[model samples]
Target: MLVSTLLERLQSDPGRPRLTWYGDDGERIELSGAVLANWVAKTTNLLVEEYDVQPGSMVGVNLPVHWRTVTWALASWRVGATVVLLDGAPEDPAAGNLDVVVTDSPDSWTGSSADLVVVSLPMLARRYDGDLPPGAVDAAAAVMTYADQIIYAPEPDPGRPALTGSGVAGAAGNAVVGHDELVPEAGPEEGVRTLVDGRGRAADVLRQLLRVWAAAGSVVLTGPATAAALEADTARRDRLVATEKIERIA
Candidate 1:
C-alpha cells in the first residue's frame, strides 16, 4: 500500500509515545501514536475536503524539520498526494505542477497558482496569527475543526512517485523515490526506541521516520543543527539518551 502502515500500526498502542520533537526554540512536543494519528487524520481530511487533493496530486512541502512538517507529510501521503520537498526553493519539474503547497513562509508562495496552506510553526498555535495572502488557507486555525478520524481515500498507485525534490544528485536533479520503494510492509512490533537526526534533509528525515515506525518504534527527534550540534554536545546527547531511554541513534 502506498499509505504507510506506520500510522495504522500505531493504533494498537495509542498511549505509547510514537514521536517526540524537541524544537530549537525551546519547545518540546510529544505525540503518542493516537495523537499523531489524529493529527495526520485531521490534516488528511482537511486536504481532501477543503483542497480537493487526491491520488496523483502533487503536494509541495516547503518547511523546516519540525513536528508540524512531519504531520503534513503523513497527511499528504494518506490522501495519496505525492510529497515534493520544496525546502523553500524547488528547481524541479514537479514543483511547477503542485496541486497544493504547505509552507511556514506563505509570502514566498503567495504568488503561486497552487492552493496554499500556511502552517504555524508553534504546536500550541491554533491559528497562524500572521496575515495570509488571498486564497491562502489558515491550516492551524482550520485543522481543529476537522474530523479526528480520517475518511480514507482510495489506494494510490504504488509505482508512482511518493517523494521528490530530495537533495540527492540525479539526472533529473530531483531525487525521486517511488511509493513501492518507500513504504514498507508492516514489521514486528518491537517498539524500538531511537534518536532521529532532525538536521538532515526532509527526505532523509522522512525515510528514517518510516524505518523506525515500521518496527513499531518510538523516536526522539533532535532539533536542527543548532549552536550545540548533536555531535559536539556530548552532554546533551547523554542527557537525551538517558532521559528518552534511547536504544540507538538513527
Candidate 2:
C-alpha cells in the first residue's frame, strides 16, 4: 500500500510540483503531483496489460536517476512488483535472472534473449526516434496507450517485497517508509524546495526523493552541478533552505 499512500498524498495536492528533473543535456522537466500520478497509472496499466507484471514479480530497472525511473518504481509497487535496480541491462551470466528488465541504453539486450523494455528518456516523455533493439518493447510508445485510471482485480499487499538492491537486502512495502526515514532531517518542510545531488547511486537518489515527498516538499535535482554554478544560480539557491549542504550542490 506504499504506492497507494504516496499517490493519495500526491492527489491531495495535485497542482504542487513534486519532482523537478534536470537532464545531463540541460533539459528541464517539471512534473506536478497530478501529472506524475497520471503517468504512474498509465505505467501500471502497461505493466499489467502488456507485460503481465503481477504481484511477486521481479522487475529490473536498469535506468539512471531520472523522472521516468521514479514513475517505473511507483508503477511497479502499485502492482505489487519487487523492483531490482540494475546499472544496465544484465549481460553477465552471473547477473542473475529477471522477469523483466527496463533500460534506456540503446544497445541493451541487443543480442540477448531476455524480456527488455527500452525508454527514450525524451524531454517530453516521447518515444525513441531511432531503431530499437530486437525483442525490446518501447516503453514510451506502449505506456501512452493505457488508461489513466488503474483497474486491477486484486489489491497489492503491503507486506510483499517492494524493492531489492544490487547486493543489499530487499525491503517490503511496509518497511520502505522506515528505510527512507532513517536519515534524520532528511525530510524537508511542506512546500520547501530541496536540492538533491544526482551523482550517487540511482537507488540512493530515489530514496532521498521519496523522503522529500513524504514531507510534502518539492525537489530540485541537478546532475553533477559545480559549486560555482550553484553560487551563480542565486535564484535557485535562495529558494533552497540553509540546511542543504554544499556537498549536495556538487
User: What does each candidate score in C-alpha RMSD?
Assistant: 2.6, 4.8
lDDT tens digits, residue span 1-250, model 2: 1666767787798998777776767677888999998989999888888778977777888787777888998888777777777755466432356677788875866655557788878766578777887767888788888898886624566656666655323344332322223222433355566678777777677777777776767777766553236567987665543533222332
Worst 10 residues of 2 by lDDT: 175-184
- Supply the TM-score for candidate 1: 0.91
Which residue pairs show backbone clashes in model 1? none
Cα lDDT, model 2, residue 135: 69
Candidate 1 off by > 4 Å:
89-94, 168-174, 185-189
Candidate 2: C-alpha lDDT: 0.70
Using all chains and alpha carbons, the TM-scores for the candidates as numbered come to: 0.91, 0.80
